[model samples]
Target: MSGPWTEWDHLLKVDPDKTLVDGETFEDVCQTGTDAIAVGGTTGMTEEKMATVVEACGKYDVDLYIEPSHSNAVVHDDSLDGYLIPIVFNAGDISWVTGAHKEWARLDDDIDWARTFTEGYIVLNPDSSVAEYTQADCDLDAEEVAAYAEVAEQMFGQDIVYIEYSGMLGDPEKVAAAQNELDDATLFYGGGIHDYDSAHQMAQDADVVVVGDLVHDEGVDAVRRTVEGAKDA
Candidate 1:
């Protein structure tokens, strides 16, 4: 509750691939009224592509962060606020939990721990790129998801606990269960949030609601509405 991410109650995650595909620029999306902007994606990720997006977002005064899916996709830029790396808690592959972390630390010497934040993710999309890459365990019940959240906060000392439903809409009861289990750690819920109502509902359940794909598919106007809903929630 007291760190670089403490103020981010509503975030808009923009995937560079999708943004460019939708024919919208990052400068326009950065002004969508979100508390922060997270740049990253599960597929087709590269340092060059990330740098392009970061450079555009740097023009804005908003907090800009990178959520790198792999070590190869990480970008080194002073303009970026920091990194938001994910540790998939229910990943079927152990590599997603810790193996990649060790590799990144070994490869990159510029990782400032003070500016870094780790998000413990319970990915719940069976068909998402993240789910496919991490081999996520998406069959857990609400109670079980809550247990993972507790472990992330107490054992791992995670700064953020993310319930990621990805391509599918999330279950509010599951989000609430994780929120109830966590004490000080920030809870972030992402997935299927394309409009005001869904974003508002998720905002009520978690400390932060992350909207992705919506901005690419529906444009910044739709993303702005979600930002309003999240803040007003």
Candidate 2:
């Protein structure tokens, strides 16, 4: 049950393709008490962009990770604590599930297996860019969601099961459903966690609450509040 993410209660996801709130630097964001910083995006991701964010956050002491969307965007850096490669469980297109991972293995000869792990992702937001890009099936009921979580843990042997509602708030009932099925795989909940209450609500069931887009929109102050919320839960 213990790994790089075992003690993590909050994760601040930084999109390489987007800018942070005006005047707020990576230093500010990194010091927000988030357990880790996840660098990635659904689109416009390249090695240069990934490196930019990684380097900025590298100066800090917090754990840093790359959630590579594709092989082209993967950056090898000593600053990264690990790679949280996402395998979309409900992707309508098979590429999100296996094709992208295969391509990364083929293209990158220097993969650090010791510092890499897979995240079983169930993208459940119909309007999110990740959903559209991966062609994810987002109309599942609570039972269906739990089944995916079960398969991700039991069949795939994933260390983490992520319930992602990319841009909007997700149903707490569905998140709890996924939690009920997992025995050891850490449950991560993300999307629409813009404030303290939303973060607390999701953190109650999810082992780690991931916050993205909030820092870009509201700055580090808002991010600090969510960190408190997640820890408080």
Candidate that scores best on TM-score: 2
For candidate 2, lDDT tens digit of each residue in 148-182? Answer: 99999999998899999989999999999999999
For residues 1-233, what per-residue lDDT tens digits would candidate 1 score against the true structure? 47666677789898877654366677778888898999999898988888888998988889999999889888878888889999999999999999999999999988888778889999987889899899988898999999999999999999799999998888999999999999899999999998889889999978888999888788988998999888889
TM-score of each: 0.96, 0.99
The 10-residue segment with the lowest total lDDT in model 1: 16-25
In model 1, which residue pairs have backbone atoms overlapping below 3 Å?
A: none
How does model 2 score by TM-score?
0.99
RMSD (Å) per prediction: 1.3, 0.8
Candidate 1's C-alpha runs over 4 A off are 20-23
